[model samples]
Target chain A: MKRFIFLLCLFLPALSWAQLTIQIQKGADKPLSVAIVPLAWNGPSLPEDIASIVGSDLKRSGQFAPLPSGNMLSMPHEASEVVYRDWRALNVDWLVVGKIVPMQNGYTVQYELFDVINQRQVMLDREVGYNDSLRDVAHAISDKVYEKITGIRGIFSLKLLYVSALRDAQGQNTYRLMLSDADGAREQILRTQREPLMTPNWAPDGETIVYVSFETRRPAIYMENLRTRARQQLTNFPGINSSPTFSPDGRKLALVLSKDGNTEIYVMDVATRELTRLTNQIGIDTEPAWTTDGRSILFTSDRGGKPQIYKVSATGGNADRLTFDGTYNARPRAMPDGSGFVYVHRESGDFHIVLQDTKRGVTRPLTQASLDESPSVAPNSAMLIYATLYGGRGILAAVSVDAGSRYLMPSRFGDVREPAWSPFVDRR
Target chain B: MTYKNLGLSLGVVLAMALAGCSSNKAADSANQNGANSGLGSNSSSTFDPSANGNGSNLAQNGRIVYFGYDQATLSSDGQSVLDSNISALKSGSQHIRLEGHADERGTREYNLALGERRANAVLQYLVANGVSKARIETISYGKERPADVGHDESAWSKNRRVEIVLN
Candidate 1:
């Protein structure tokens, strides 16, 4: 369990640290080979695949390589129907089998995970939900199986927010802010405008998200409540009002504003609307992300004459440059554990995602794209997704924290960008 | 209004002389100034400079300015374009919006700031040339509103332009 210090305890009298407590699961490094058989459908219509979601979820974590359905010798829906010798001959370490039965309320999904080497059942779980939320139900089961095996919570239930620029039939480009599942299902449009939207950051509770929208004819940060769909303009500074991120405690926001004549980092208490200036730099100091601890902010700056990750106290002090390996390193997204950070690094004519361990002073590139950007880390710290151009179109791709596993979140339509991974949402 | 006087005072020397003097010398000066005056008509007219055989390019109709890669400061061509837009902007009651833009090469946040810097650079030039601050509003589309969708430098160069949107 991770404990938050309640960074704003002094200012917020009624604040409880319990509400802010969030665990940042360190991802398992050793890859595990697992097999997930296609779930037997008891209903006429199979809205979703519980096995595929669980397989994809586990595969996305960089922890497991799920055997493709075609490669399996037999399809078994339950432990009694399993052929242990066949799976053992296939060299699989773990096996998962499930079946979905349609009920009056929704569907009942029964899944069982087995240790193929031990020839014994490890977990048997059942999940029930409304018919409309079949995708959610699949993710819920994935979460249970993942945590049971990896000892880390699954983030498949968490959603992602991103901006996609698609040209309509009129040949006019329209920008849309979208709310979508991690598995690329049930895409809901939050807002659509001709003007560009950028830099979306999620509030800790996953109830509100703040993003920069140009609908007002200028870049301004707006905080929107997900439940009510109500939005309030947060900042409309004269020069540039963009790049807003919620502090870990959810009490304050760490953002970039140029209202003072130069782009600099600033913080505002969400409740009081009180603004506190952080970095004062002559050069561009933008893209502010709060450290998981909430005591410091990591941001991208060119104070060193080129863009690199820089760190400064959440309250305002001397900014310390954190990167030196590359000529360009910007958009510093600190991991949930604060163990290290992930950033867009430009090296050898390509912009790729890289993870930098602050304590160890080690840097590792996590992607191989020509223009990978807008990396949003999973709540579990197990994986991250970033926007990259594939086949001349913008697409979002995910990679494990260790750069061990990778997959592309299939681009639905148009050019997508600025993926903001939602925090681990509260269970419904 | 004050704008007409300012326009007359700025580069519309012929308009000033035509306003100040008798209509007699105005024809002679118009001939001397050639079609550059009518061809250089600002926001107040339906004249297209391309209509004449001048072949001086679209810069002749000037309200837009272009910049080099990764640069916010205007080039010689950009400065000349702004120089021509001043008189028309002065003569009109319309609010001038300098919509700054950049190529799709950098991060959105940084590009936004860069775009604003480019717009501010143009704003300063207009203010330096006597366009009122109240009559001008600036917005940065950054790389979002690309004039060209191609990925090459040709497309990028076209996208790295600040549109002089006069309303």
Candidate 2:
């Protein structure tokens, strides 16, 4: 009986790993055509098709148009297989081929990238993973191929943290904090509660997450270690406690608190729990985010009578208004490159995610969907995921930073929002 | 106006208020009367927000005040609801908890601040009307806890509110 229960427990998580459906709305005007051939397998039949996963990852970026496997004239696993003429004939700019060989306990995946036009091998690499982790191995190969072809780091291996809520017939909501791969696969529920959960963000190290929860019938900030599943309530102030963002170094957290009579920006040391008040204006100051260098914080404030993005030094000082193009702009998220920031801008009563290039003094809207908010950019700054109302349901959507690609990730269960894209972490 | 006349006017205003919203009318009317009669003469027999309900249920109803979108200021209707409770709030020994909420429209964190501003508005009004500051506690739930889950204006109007919990 114990062994049967153990097996059931081990398999239940796999059975419950529901994936979000991806609907590509738009792609680049001239996406590079690439072909990822089926990786030849020399082992027991694997449950996952590694090549297909890699192909999907690359195609989802909107920078590449993966060729259908049926269109491929020949499948070459190595550079020596030649036959470059076949790929050239297919009008494929890039080609990827690999093979999976089973070892005693794991599998070895060897993949090679080729420039069909140049007829030259671009990259050759191998990765090893256990039976259950073939997906990760495939993602690593995708990352390598994406980087080699585009000269930009890939975000396929990154994870996403978001909140999913389902309202029952009684109108009571059940909220779940969910984690999944950037492609919306390998989903895992981090926490579930009867109360609402909001503003979940990852620490820079990717080992800890901080979020606001109303589990105590009052909003409070909490942090949980991912690897150990250790949970700790970080703040339980008298009033609103929310929008906790980790500093780039992960040693401090910038958040908003109303305990001091009005909502104001504050920073807390992660180690000693010491607090430092940063803003003293009577306006509603909240949604504090750190700059890439950790020297300043960008936040939302209404001191000027409408919500707008503002910036202040990390230690505490006067804030300079950062947005002026819109009457209502709030929830500023600094881009990974520090060249610009992304925020919610109200345009003709519809809220859309807009990217502000600080250096160029130019602003661009990354999403056309109405009611778009809570944008979290990938570590590589190539793409961003945000929550948008689609068909009256709150679903997650992704758009490339340059506004070339767009896709929606609607879950099978309920409303999903507040997508926080994870930083790149070493899986090995 | 006489206490009875005041109760009658408040009741009429509350009925119109309840009629304007698409939520549960019976519940809103009952609560509206309960909020109005808390400070006036305890003769809740004639001014019950509900048609068939008595004074016993008055304390539980009428504790919520609605607001406009992205607004933290108290509406005249909200002020009337509070004005009716002035005596009861000033004399009551129970702690007053003002829980603020916002509709699911804008960003969550900004809504948090907006909710706080709404609750603080109510707190300032109570303090200005002779209620001790020590008797009240305020908290903002932002858009997290929506009284009405619908996405339209009818629901959003109902969700943007402050509930007075006497404990």
Candidate 3:
């Protein structure tokens, strides 16, 4: 089977690290405070800093606040070497001790998670990958540690796609659709267009990504495979062909095209390229996102005279208004658990991310940002990343599902927007 | 002689850093430079010192009609601008491109639809004023193209406009 992991370089290498600076505004009230004891390195050198990766992963989730490496009193390479008393004195909930041994073919990362109160080892597992892929191995270790503690699968290994824009000194605007690690590292540019690029979405199978580009001097949908780097123009109709979203099954793509008339939703088969018109509203029916079950599509329509989140059957029918509390609610992204969805909710002239519980009939704002858009829920539905303005500069930020913790992924150079966190990839 | 064409190239410098892999883009931009040099010189010679902006000033000139926040309908000022363009819009020899835009507010996709609606409103207005529908083509840049880079209303009102480009 072909894995969707990116191991190829078809574009000039993009920058790494330092681009997305993290600022932890808040986190879970009772964050599982832990100490990540610096691991003993047994290699000539290391391509990846495993300890920092794991620590950042845990901290980014807003679940665990790792003790700074400088504060760790003892640097234990193994659980047997760990002084449990030292951690208990620090009042840390857990202690993570690890070691890296260089193998002839690759390297083995052996890590152990210990419960401070119980005074016992909880997780002891080893992952082996080529030294070149140590970053992936580190993320795999983070996933294990996270699941062991929270009982929820971790999404540290998944990828995130976003668009960044910069105005060159030559008086021209430059845009880039970038792919990066969940921690905002190893950014790779997928495509470059002179006009504008918008709304990058992932295919359910995790193989290809769809986005709207004005390369042809008009808004049209395009898809590019992550593995092959092959691109194909999906739609080039007369009018607009924007907001392309892959259906839950990955067999179809529901998008907004203004060919037949005003902006409306249409689904096209992936293989045959056959089109199925979904919404036929003259008023505006755009931003078509499918529910997890694939039976219905949630979109934003202005047919009622105000932009509101509405749901229509996949085949086409009446669109029931799902949001009423706010005067403006657009960009509805369905969570994986079938429990309502998230969208940009505008109130008092400030726009924030809000989660609407479909079954419970309750909606609450999750972000306090005055200007936020393009919210993408992680594969595990535990967190989401969206674009918002920070100090007049556009940046990407993440918020936990319960609105417990938040972090801003601020780009150092230009404005960043339209972030689409990838679906879960490493099922192993 | 009445007005010098301010002659801005409007850079179209939209760069998508799809990375340096675009080895042909250098060549493409070179060719674009060659093709636009004539227009550049023509406008430079007719340069009106009073006109502001050094970049794509097409949208900044009087050809654009501003709109209210979030509303696609035309205001009297906007209508008057289009009213002044009636003679030119009715000229069978001219092809008009109505490029709609929006302020940096709301979701990008929704703003795109709104921009399209705004453009269509302009197209409908022109058609009602005796301009042939076949002579006009419309596209919405959403909030991508801004006349002014500022985030306040002064910048937004100018960004939220429809530009009538004649070719």
In order, what lDDT does every prediction score?
0.75, 0.82, 0.79
Query: Taking the tens digit of each residue's C-alpha lDDT, what string does model 3 give over A1-428?
Result: 13434433432453443467788889899898888877788558777788898998999899998999888778887877978888888888988888888788888878899998899999899989786688898888898889899989888888888988875433356778888888888787776555688999999878799998887667888899988878999999977889999988899999998988789999899999999888877689999899999999999998888999999998987889888886899999999888889999999998999999878888888999789999998878889899999988899999999999999999987788998888875566
Residue range A1-428, candidate 2, lDDT tens digits = 99897567556557764758899888999999999999988666897898899889988999899999998898888888859899888899999988887788998988889998998988888999987898999888889999899989988888899999876532336798988888888788777787789999999889799999888778899999987778999999999899999999999999888888888999999999999999998888999999999999999999999999999999998999988886889999998888899999999888999999888988999987668999998888889999998887789999999998999999887789999998876555
A390: Cα error in model 3, Å: 1.0
Clashing pairs in 3: A174-B15, A175-B15, B4-B46, B10-B56
The stretch of ten residues in a row with the least summed lDDT in candidate 3 chain A is: A1-10
Q: What's the candidate order when arranged by decreasing DockQ?
A: 2, 3, 1
Which residues of candidate 2, in runs, are more than 4 Å off?
A: A1-12, A17-19, A426-428, B1-61, B90-92
Interface RMSD of 2: 10.5
Better of 1 and 3 by TM-score: 3
DockQ leader: 2
Model 2, docking class: acceptable
Candidate 1 stretches greater than 4 Å from native: A1-31, A40-43, A60-63, A68-83, A99-104, A168-171, A410-412, A426-428, B1-61
Output the better candidate (1/2) by DockQ: 2
lDDT of 1 by residue, B36-70 (tens): 43423432222111122222212233645778876
Tell me how far the alpha carbon of residue B32 in candidate 1 is from the true structure, in angstroms, after superposition.
32
